[model samples]
Target: MKKLLIILLVLTGTTAIKAQTRTADESAIEKTWARFGNSWRNQNFSDMKDYMTPDCHWINVVGMHWRNLKEVQFAHQAFITAFLKDAKAVDKSSNLRFLTNDVAIMYRVTHIGAFYPPDGIDHGTNKQGDKDNIATIVFVRQNGKWLIASGHNSDVVAQAAASDPVLHMNK
Candidate 1:
């Protein structure tokens, strides 16, 4: 009986250690997301660039795609230069899944509001739409830091319906 109790205690202790380690990893990944949001709100495109890998890719709600880091950087720089003079964003992490110790997928919601210069290019159309959307970001730990590997952004309602069975009850 004493031997069985010791074995059980060891198993529980191992589980507790794993849980703590997993929580630490999640917190670190969350910080990466927070940094991405801060970049948008603070207009720090350099930080944004740093958060992504060289071959990182992204597809937006409008079907616009950025295929690589350079392309993403160029687009972000253009927006910052020509618009987004008064841009604000709040990013919240909604869900996370770890595929491996080095890879994670995160779902988040971002609310963005922007005011473009009156004479700026594409001023007639609010390019960002100043609304909330859902984003899925794939992060891979490279050389000890988390960086975005790929991402997709789309309408919140659509994503929620697809992800939540409770929301899809009728259809």
Candidate 2:
């Protein structure tokens, strides 16, 4: 019985240690995300270019597709200048899944705050007054640094019908 007890303790300790540890890749990815968030808040798309691959693809919340890094930088700069100059991006939560040692996908929920329409334009807001979007970004490690390869952002909408049993069980 004493031997069994010792084995169980050892197993538990191993599990706890593993749970508390994060790989270097995970730490690097987290830092990359922090830098991206900072760039967005600063409205510095030029700095953001360094984080993305030259052939990066991005799809915005409104369904506009940017096919390359140049397009992505240009569109973000224009949009921020015209409408979202004062908007701030707050990352609510994120989950990263690795497909390979060099490739990972991150799903992030971000809140856009301090939003206001430009010059008498009325872009209606939700009841919460702020907007939340979910972004799925693919990151690929190139030359020891992770770079954004592709991404898609979609507005998070609360729909009661989506939770209905009939719709959920359709699959």
Candidate 3:
């Protein structure tokens, strides 16, 4: 019985060490996201590049896909120029877990306060409200640092009932 107890204690100690190590990884990834959000709100998008991989991919809430860093930059720049007059972003992450020693997946709900234009540009958007959305990002650890590899975003949609014609339309 004493031998069994010793073995169990050793196993528990090993598990504790792993959990503590992964918590550090989680903190690092979370800090990366914090930097990204700060850059976004400040309209200092150039700073965000450092947190993303060279080949990072992003899917915006509007279903537009950015396949590369340059594409993502262009998209964000356009949005910042045209729509984002003044805004701030707050994100809460949950279910953040490491998929492997070098990868993590987390669900984030981002609440953005976006000031809208009087008339939206070519995309035909006029109505604007507080934009809140859920997003998932995969962070990959490379060279002992975390960087965003890919992200998918889905807006928290609000509309009328299905029976209403307005339901199918963007408000």
Candidate 4:
């Protein structure tokens, strides 16, 4: 009878240890999402794929969509070229949660440095373009690493501010 009691206690202890370990792994996955946000803002695509699955899907409010890692990387490169042309990059990430051991979600906010057009072009040339926005990343754990399986972005457009500058410039 005593032996049976000892065995039960050992089982309970082992289960608790596993639960704690799983929690830690989940937290690490969330941190990976945060790191991805930082890398994207800095235009470090080289390491970006490490956080995403090869088959990840991405989309933005402009209707731009990417289905594979290659496309996703290229899309990001385009964004970096169009904007942040000599500007500092900054980002904030948070709101990470796991729906299951293999699935998670997080949000990020990025700020692009001051933008200026070519020497002859006006600074307000692209004022009508999109600005600061929010991105939601969904991750899935496969094998041993957490990968971003899907992403969605909702761009922030300061319609009032944008229209005013453009209209005033034409005046």
| Pairs of colliding residues, candidate 3 | none
lDDT of 2 by residue, 1-171 (tens): 999999999999988776554377788888887877777777778887678899999998779999999998898878777567767788899999989879999999998765554422346752221677899999999999988999999878657447768865756
lDDT of 2: 0.80
**lDDT, each prediction:** 0.78, 0.80, 0.79, 0.71
How close to the true structure is residue 19 of candidate 3, measured as C-alpha lDDT? 90
Q: Please give, for residues 106-129, the per-residue lDDT of candidate 1 as tens digits.
A: 988877664554334465664554
Per the 3 Å backbone cut-off, how many clashing residue pairs does candidate 3 have?
Answer: 0
In model 1, which runs have C-alpha deviations exceeding 4 angstroms? 114-128, 157-171
> Which candidate number has the best TM-score?
3
Clashing pairs in 2: none
Candidate 2: where are CA atoms >4 Å away?
A: 1-22, 114-129, 160-171
Q: Taking the tens digit of each residue's C-alpha lDDT, what string does model 3 give over 1-171?
A: 999999999999999999999889989998998877777767767866788888999998778899888887777767765676465667754679778899998899877765565423435565454777788898999888899999988876655234667757887
Which regions of candidate 4 are displaced past 4 Å? 1-19, 86-89, 111-125, 128-132, 156-171
Top lDDT hit: 2
| Clash statistics: count for each candidate | 0, 0, 0, 0
Question: In terms of TM-score, how similar is model 2 to the real structure?
Answer: 0.75
lDDT of 4 by residue, 23-140 (tens): 8876777677767657656766777678878998999656789999998877776665665445554565457777886787877665644555333234656442235667788889
Model 4 gets an lDDT of: 0.71
For each candidate, give its TM-score against the true structure.
0.78, 0.75, 0.79, 0.66
